[model samples]
Target chain A: MAQHSLEVIVENSPGVLARVAGLFSRRAYNIERLSVGPTSNPETSKMEIVVNLEGHALEQVIAQLDKLINVISIKEIVPNAAKAIVHDTQPDYQN
Target chain B: MSQMNGASSLVASLEAAGVDVMFGIPGGAILPAYDPIFSSSIRHILVRHEQGAGHAATGYAQVTGRVGVCIATSGPGATNLVTPLADAAMDSVPVVAITGQVPSVAIGTDAFQEADIRGITMPFAKHNYLVTDPADIPRAIAEAFHIASTGRPGPVLVDIAKDALQKLTEFNYPNSVSLKGYQPKLSADAQSILDAAALIAASSKPVFYVGGGVIKANASRELLELAQLLGAPVVTTLMARGAFPDSHPLHLGMPGMHGTVAAVTALQKADLLITLGARFDDRVTGKLSSFAVNAKVIHADVDPAEIGKNRFVDVPVLGDLKFTIAALIPALKVALAKNRPDLTPWLRQMNSLKAAYPLGYDTPKDGSLSPQYVIERLGKISGPDTIFASGVGQHQMWASQFISYENPRTWLNSGGLGTMGYAVPAAMGAKVGAPDTTVWAIDGDGCFQMTNQELTTCALNNIPIKVAIINNESLGMVRQWQTLFYEGRYSNTSLESKRIPNFPMLAEAMGCVGLSCDRPEDVDATIEKAMSINNQPVVVDFRVNRDAMVWPMVAAGTSNDEIMIARETAPDWDSQEL
Candidate 1:
């Protein structure tokens, strides 16, 4: 199955990450790439959540994340795009 | 691109990430970074040694549940940090190590104090960065912090070439980093939760084996609720010392090496071992084949690698601890309330077993201070909020036994690595993390002498941490092993003539008050006096009995049932009386 990358923006808080990640886990979606950091604004953080799933399942994962309270937006950043160059450059070797 | 010093941009990025402190020891290679450290708002604590700095950062990260930042120079300084970085990695503590490397021009030419630190620390670090260009500094710092503090938190290293730090570049720090293959599984399936609940409900003897993940995921409330509802006895790992209230009826102290007999026995007897946020480390499960052999394991952890790494898991739920626990709580509550399994009989049996192999110590009639008594008294006087940071050895075990840590992040120790001299610096970090809480550094004479120089750092920062030293006049743990297993061969275990500097005198030299207690009666008074002084650090040398050994110890490679309780029973002591 092809891996799909989804970027989620949420409020930087204690349990927000857990909730957002919980959404995909409930559906049994395998998260392939997940990155979270502060956005330009301090109050919010952009989470780049990538999961390996069929195209149809990927769409549902994005939609489910968008439904969260603190979630501002959910974008499917192409997994092979230049934006993911950092991860591609250094293969995640540690298992 | 606008021109800005790489060091300045690095500092800006760190500050942007809300990092307020940098613990390190400066050297020639890192002079540029040190310059910015002084001008910037972020505070710098110059540790006596680079290793202490890394551990201090770990201590800070563990207590605050934030990414700790530490810096060091090239070669030796960076090498010193390797142990602490490895220690942090082993414990899954979030720490970021920023080290200055030799200039780009001198990279492979064997420049002065040059070392392949990035290569050295690759296995130990979650991820590492080597900044050859000035422009990469900003992105590297941001990514380093992100990698360190994120899912299944661990240490990350960023090696900046000295030339890069000195060079100027555009100060644009990347607001975000996109990485592939680093996805942290953060959610538990609803069905998995149901399955876990079913197992919990079906099993008559269920036990919750918790680790540092409980604190990391902030799932204490959920863990407590599940345990209470199911009436399952909870045994916390050494790293998860304070995850559950030590005084709770279900709290079966720490389980692993030096774990209480009751707790380890419970693990063995449990039909269902619902491991939440705990990896069955070898120390905790001495021989994996014999560990919880009869139990149906339900492992719930954020890290997927830990699922079947040690023991076979009947049900593996890969998700954040809080979410998994939250999902399981409702199901467990319903199942427990409906079925109402009479766990009272099992609990009574466990209590009986605990009573049979009770952890106790004898007060010498010849009038010598006991480390156990001192720690117990300290525990009694201190509030639940008081934090206990400990150094390795018998004193650490004593502190683990006597100290009743009720809250998560309240107890910090080098549990996985068992690094000596971890207490004082770690306590400094804990005090920094939680300024209002009473932080105590419980150290042994042998361990205290290893990093006592950090007292200057505490004094400089005016961080008032009370340090209680259990002076046994020998390396108590090793000596005990030698006495028991080696037929008292004695060889190098005796610390006689090691001549530790009088702690009180050394404390005075470091601009702090110090006290010494020789008599058992003076322990309370000494601790009180030390705690009262809030302005500066205080060190108390507690002259404990030399031959004191932590009892109820399970010999290595032995089953949990093989525990050595106290040699003799005292008139005042009765396990059932409590």
Candidate 2:
């Protein structure tokens, strides 16, 4: 299984974290590391989820995550650019 | 603006959403909400159990094409809804579930009748909310219904804290819910539609693999148009029984395990498969690697994830089936104008295969009533317009196989989850949804005992749903597996139904008109008598042969190629040439 990372922006609501975590377990996808924190915007949060899944499984994972109504946007963060993306997080995050 | 408690706001929100009726039992946490419901125009059917309320909501939604609603309290009452919520999620039924939560201050303290229901149902519900603030009641309820009834459609849950319910709040219902990232696509990409049309025009053996989404989108008319234009055969899945008419010349019946031979073989031998709104479920694909080995699939579905989740597709169209099929018809017409492939020989081969292996069963040598015959008779007496609900088991399969459905939503069963005891309550809900039409619950002896108490709910509510129990004195499907795979050990499968609480007596005790038929000749008369009684619920216990089995079955985890026409009989696949 190849390790992949996804940066997901979601409405910062109660149970949003649990909803994301529960989806992984329910669909039997393996999660390696998950880091969640409040975004610059108080209405939404950012979640950097790392999973141990192959290319096809990663696509399915992305599609499933996209179905969550609270989820705003998702992008695949390359390993090399992860630091730059994380450091450059600003308050202007838009929905 | 009127000020009221959050509980009253919840009722007002549901009423504004146009919910005519709901199902549930009142409890401490949810009791405040019941006060408004009692005086409101929206009718609330007090179910015997929370599970029944959930499944009934699903049934109502399935038949009426509207969002069904159910309510329950904290702890066990909320948790009991897990099964039906899962069932609705699996079947893509539109249902909104409301639960009362513990007081916000005492939530983590594990106060009396407290459970984190919002967290528990998160895995399956389309979306969920935990509202601790009384002011958020209207918004949460509005979003819950919007999420439940739109997109691909599934159950949604909204849990309000007890203190929030009691707190006075100003109510303002939202004109429209606006979820930032939840947009359901209604139309497919134009290029994908053209590509699918080209395939349909060029392919010799093309099969329309229809799923429940067609019915969900109300696109059966468009499907018929496309199929007739191409002169190709159509095969509906178990969840899609009524999406395509059974009597249509181009229809090949249900496909998958226990599917008709023609339907199964057409999929296996097809050059192109037009898969509409169906996920390639394991029961249908049976050893996925070997299924439809030669077919290039064009999968169109409302859920983007379902397109390539199981099968590789030559063309993937992400849109509602209603629009996808409508778009395809015109594109296919244009493609056919260029070069239409003759499908006569392919259609001939399928017809012959259908005739060679038509669905039939043998009479029991012991003179016991045949389950298949009884179901066939039941379907004939009830007619095509009648709505049929079934519990999981041999009887469920028989009901789907024998019944003729011409209209969408006529057949309602727990196809994906295969939950037992779904028939009675679901049928009750169907009756409530479509009061003018007849609704029948075709259940098994084992399945009946699971939720038969719902008969009391139906009788008291004046729902008047009819039930026919195909009693084989054992779990027939499990016994069939044991008979074939486990050396006939029997192994606790028997219910000893012969000596148990007599079914007719049990029905009468529950305030229903009960009848029993042990012999073959009495089946029709018993059904007719049950049909005649519209004043209250009716139950007819049908004593059938215990050893009967569902044939044309592909055993668990096997390939469709290994399907058996009967015990030890496989089809001569080589003889058929297309």
Q: Candidate 2: which pairs clash?
A: none
Instruction: Candidate 2: list runs displaced more than 4 Å.
Output: A78-95
Tell me the lDDT of model 2 at B540.
92
Model 2 agreement with the true structure over B192-274: per-residue lDDT tens digits: 99999998888999999999999999999998988898889999999999998999999899998899999999999999999
Model-by-model DockQ, in order: 0.03, 0.24
Off by over 4 Å in 1: A1-95, B337-340, B355-357, B497-499, B567-578
lDDT of 1 by residue, B1-578 (tens): 56878888778878988899879989999889888789888989888899889888988998899999899999999999998899898889999999999999999999999998877875457767778898988888888887787778899899999999988888887878765435566778888888888888888888899999999898899888878878878999988988999889888787876787778878988898999888887668865657787889999988765776566678989899988998898888777776767777779867776666556788977888888999998988877888899999999988988888898998888888889988988888888888888999999888888888888999988788889988887889999888878988878866651256787888889977888998988888888888899999999988888888877666677655555564332212244332
Please, what is the whole-model Cα lDDT of each candidate in the order they appear? 0.81, 0.90
